[model samples]
Target: MLNHYRIMLVLCSSVLTLVGCTNEKAFERTQVEGVVTLDGAPVEQGVITFIPAGKGATAGANIESGKFVIPKEKGPSPGDYRVEIDSSVPTGNKILDTDGETMVDEYANAIPPKFNRLTELKVTLKNGNNQHLFDLEKE
Candidate 1:
């Protein structure tokens, strides 16, 4: 009788352990993809960041040829976020580096402040995939 009870207890413990080890994430994340365009032209290369409005993880992705994709594994949790997109263009000039060791190409942000520093862009990410298109205009 004691041996049977011990076996039952071991089985129950095993089941509990398995349940605890099941594939479950502590926080949920959703995939996000989008395109970034400036004045009707695709951005060649840039970076897009999502700053959570509330308590959540911030996510970002690289924009390549006007497309950006944040996979579900590295996506942000469902919430409101402030979007920031930035791209730089070479000024066709070279200047001395701050390190005072080499010359560096001068570059400037192609996107306006309205899309980054003083951004007016906002997005709400849901439980599923999210897609967005940003057509920014220069002021």
Candidate 2:
């Protein structure tokens, strides 16, 4: 019984050491929120992504009723970010009968290609909470 206890104690100590060693430093992030509009109209449904201008995690949020909020925990650390917005709608129309009535989703770039695929909008975030409103135009 004593021998078994010694083995168990060693095993437990090893497991505890491994668990403690797994800790990694977590960085502070700025909370971000904003409204997205295109041509003076709110983007009804979509997603907004912020890619770090230099080196950092890419963060995103779902757009609902033209609003998006990125909590600090899930948002990127304070830095420059390029913004991209995209939205899609179901056309309720089939693509081709040859492919057994394949349905196609109608995708719209409400913010314009220049704002998404060719993003030109840049935002700077400071520590803590940050709020910014975006008014985009295709032209």
Q: Looking at model 1, which ten-residue stretch has the lowest summed lDDT? A: 19-28
lDDT of 2 by residue, 42-130 (tens): 88899999989987778999999889999988998798889888877665554654566766555444456777888898999889889
lDDT of candidate 1 over 1-64, digit per residue (tens): 9999999999999999988875664557899999999999999999999999897778899999
The lDDT for every candidate, in the order shown, is 0.92, 0.83
Best by lDDT: 1
**Candidate with best TM-score:** 1
Off by over 4 Å in 1: 1-12, 15-26
Q: What lDDT does candidate 2 reach at residue 66? A: 87
Against the true structure, candidate 2 has what lDDT? 0.83
